[model samples]
Target: MAEILAFAGSNSSTSINYELVKYTASLIENHKVQTLDMARYPFPMYSADEEKQKGFSNSLIEFKGYIQQSQGLILSVNEHNGNPSGYFKNLLDWLSRLERRFLEDTTVFLMAASPGKRGGIGAMGVVQDILPRFGAEIASTFSLPSFGQVFANGEIIDQTLKEQHSEALDIFLQKLN
Candidate 1:
């Protein structure tokens, strides 16, 4: 079975993106899904001076190890002002420092969600383009727009959106096998 690591790019305790990622991960069959809450890891802002003074944090190292060990990754990004949340970006910066090509060649199922109609598309688009340069092999991508209206009771409410998500999930699962 594929060991998939799932996480949201936001550090909010009640993040919709985290809920979306958890739901998507649960749909996969015959897989061990490990979910990460970025809030649990307290990381200082990335700065060259900080790096030179304090070196890498243990949490960053541990997070990197999890990424390295996982067979696949499921990431749902939360957009903050048309960009990745500060928490997620900081983690990415730290990971890049650890390994310039950290996600290189790793299979990733990318997704995003937001309360707005655009569904965090801006952040998702940026990630889709930039992640590959850092070594992520995107297997599939999905977006849930107007998250409050489309998701209910821990599942997708709109039939059409559900179908679209299912299709994306199917593709991601195929890659896992």
Candidate 2:
């Protein structure tokens, strides 16, 4: 069975994006799912001066290890001001320094969601553009809009949106098999 790592790109304990990622992971029938919360694996703000002096933080090292071990990835990132959250971007920078192609050979199902209409598409674009450079094969991408209205009880309630997400997940799972 493939081991897929699922995570949210935010530090908030009550992150809606995290909820969306976990819910999507549950849709997969035949995979081992490991969920990561950024709040637990905290890292200091990255800077050139910091790396020059202290080297990579243990948290970043552990994160890279997770990426290396996983066969697939399901990540949902939150948008802050039409871009990915600064914390996630910082994590990306640190991971890139550890290995240029940190997600090499892994298939990724990228997703984003928000309470508003745009549905975090801006943040999704950031991941879609960058992950490929790191050798991540994007199996599919999804964006959930009006998160509060469309999602309930840990499931997507809107029929059209649910079917769309299901199709994306099917494509991703096929790549895993």
Candidate 2 clash pair list: none
lDDT of 2 at 71: 97
Clashes (candidate 2): 0
Model 1 CA lDDT for position 162? 99
TM-score, one value per model: 0.97, 0.97
Candidate 2 has a TM-score of 0.97
Q: How many backbone clashes does candidate 1 have?
A: 3
For each candidate in the order shown, give its overall lDDT on alpha carbons.
0.90, 0.92
Please write out the lDDT profile of model 2 over residues 5-117, one tens digit for every residue: 99999999999999998899888877889999877877779899989999998878888998899999999999999999999998888899888999999999999999999
> Scored by Cα lDDT, where does model 1 land?
0.90
Looking at candidate 1, the ten consecutive residues that score lowest on lDDT are 22-31
The CA lDDT at 10 in model 1 is 85
Colliding pairs, model 1: 103-135, 104-135, 105-135
